[model samples]
Target: MEEKSGSLVEWLAPLAFILCAGWLTWHLPAFTLSWFPPKDPSQYDKLSALFARIDVTDSMTGLFGGYADAVDWAALLLLPVFGIIGVRTVRRAPMEFESWKPLDRLAVFIGRLTMMLIVLLCSVMIYEVILRYVFEAPTLWANELSLWLAGFVFLCAGLYAMQQRSHIRIFLLYDMMPRWLQRVCDIISTTLIVTFAFFLVYGGYGEAFDKFYRWETFGTVFDPPIPATLKPMVLLVMVLVAFQAIVNLISDWNAEPVIHTAADDIDQDELDRLRAAVGADGTGDLDVTRGSIQSNTPGKS
Candidate 1:
């Protein structure tokens, strides 16, 4: 029963995100209009008129420009899916060369999501091109949506880099250090990361909250709440990165040092597989040729 439940959750998580993503893509135009509906007679004064007309404090018909905001609903729906996946990931033991922690899993998921957004970004750009050149009708939302998704992609990529241990490090002198010294270096590096994350969250909290509370919009025709959403997201992901660094440091503290030499660099298993595939005898070509040469030499009867 437990196993079945776990499997169900695993299956449901990605399905939920996929369905929500598709729904958002389908209704993107409607959501964009909700934030910035068409106005009559005055282009510049439209936002002012919108604010005057819709009471920002009203919960049912206001905040986020009212119930017409389909984007918010899509986001809300995805929250639980992500939450389930995150919990499951964190509960699992760490894998070799892969952190099975919630932070790593979340970063990976966000990375994949960023890829999906790239598809959406390309689609929007292509659509905009066809509209502009072929139909001579350009959209105001396409560029802004692309920019929004690109920002998220870059942010998510930072987290993914941390998870993969692919971020820049000066390993020249560090590689030569003793294991104890290496562990000390790891501690110091992780401490610095944690400190930076702490400060970011501490200093940026008020601004993030303010933007979110006001449901601040970009004032453009599309009127995305980029600042409100992205500021908090950046700080949150940085915190996750800091935690991952700490986790890595602890996990690797007792690990054996990996020394790389020319002989050790070659993958012998891969060579053996290649030799097997080519139907070579157990001995290599060089050895066989040398044996043949020795046998054919003049002296021996």
Candidate 2:
């Protein structure tokens, strides 16, 4: 699953890149407008004269011209596609563990929390719409509020997906392997995913730092410096997720007695005891009748 984790990091790297790009656009919205703006503009030059030749009329044309709004919304739509791809990948695997550890439980709890938050966000939006259309008393905060909640949803749910292990896979050969071969394959997969996640966090640190320094904010009414706030959280969650993956991988690899599904339901300890009583390979002078209980006396072995 480390490879899957790596894939997710790769998928999300673009979003981080776009965030940095938004910062650039925020600083130089007009620079992007010209096919090639003059490298040097005089202090006295009018802003209009700079773009005088271009006939761009959209709201995003002018300096600070709502480009952030457009990009942010576009990203909001694009992100979920990658997320969906990551999720479907993991759902294809069979259930691995019979019981989960503490971190696994925590991940499930976080998932539930995020689900509730989404529901709450939807309810708020519905109420806002009713207020606007029915009574013509629209609130300015609703839209911004939705955006804020959306940031949380995006971040928290991504972590939840990691815990759920529903990321992508190239399992063309995995299904064909023997049980021991499959275990080895799982070990390799887990190692790769952890490695990838480590590098993702390492590489993203600089971009996240730059965003934080700028105190980056959404342009609209919410006007929160959410990029700065949320970027670090994403990195942190990735690290935590990587740690959880490693833990789960280790547990799976080093589990005691190697439980198997096709084996009978009898306790291994009891089976071993019966085997000892019956003699090595059951070939020596013991009763061969079926359904006969062997008598156990003190010091029989």
Candidate 3:
């Protein structure tokens, strides 16, 4: 039991790290959700005064700070949510798969990759802080470095998320259907996801290829290649995601619905003991009394 619980933790820790990294990304200004006021001008105080007055109508113009213009920061919030949710999905135990073996190995590998990206991102910021503030010399490559990391995380994690059953699904209608119909719906949905992913891969490859051909750069001191180096990853991961979706569909098709028993929602120890008494291992591999465990919810066992 200790070994089993430790195994579960091993699967969960990397996911938890990714979730924290995502939360930080969401709240941090580096991601651009936070704002910084610009250099002050004579109009700045006047604009500030106007902003203070409730009767003013040009709040939009007045809100424009710094040398340029103001923009909405709401979209930045989605980045973190996507990251966290993707990691969470990857971290979850595959109650859907009975024996850990190869399936569990794949999930763990994906989790580790996600965690590595998160750590690398954090390391960059730490380096930025030490060099920019401590050494009093800022690196122009910081922004480019961060963006590159973000792109990799986003693309690679999408595949991992799909494998973990963490992607969004509208199952309200399917949940109400009969078992056979539910399987049918699963088939249809799986087919559509594969089709969409295939097209995305095809289109994204062309787009990325063009960008690479253009020799695009960030136009900064570092002059890092923009959308050129990362383009292939975009197409690659999409293809990987499509492949994973295919595997998922095949797995689901072969898998029987979970079987629930008197110990269905009970504690693991109690469930184990009960199963032992019933001459079953509760591992979903043996048929002691009945042929199989009744399907209740996925990934619970």
Tell me, by lDDT, which candidate is best.
1
- The TM-score of predicted model 1 comes to 0.63
The 10-residue segment with the lowest total lDDT in model 1: 285-294
Tens digits of per-residue lDDT, candidate 2, 168-220, equal: 55555765666678778877877886788788888999989766544456666
**Candidate 3: misplaced stretches above 4 Å?**
1-108, 213-215, 258-301
* lDDT tens digits, residue span 147-166, model 3: 87778778767766777666
lDDT of 1 by residue, 52-171 (tens): 444333243423654344345656567576656734542222221455555556666655556566776799999999999999999999887778777777887787677767687767
Q: Which candidate is the best by TM-score?
A: 1
CA lDDT, every model vs. true structure: 0.63, 0.57, 0.56
Between 2 and 3, whose lDDT is larger? 2
User: How high is each candidate's TM-score?
Assistant: 0.63, 0.48, 0.51
Rank by lDDT (best first): 1, 2, 3
1 versus 3: better lDDT goes to:
1
Candidate 3 residue pairs in backbone clash = 38-66, 95-299, 258-294, 258-295, 259-293, 259-294, 259-295, 260-294
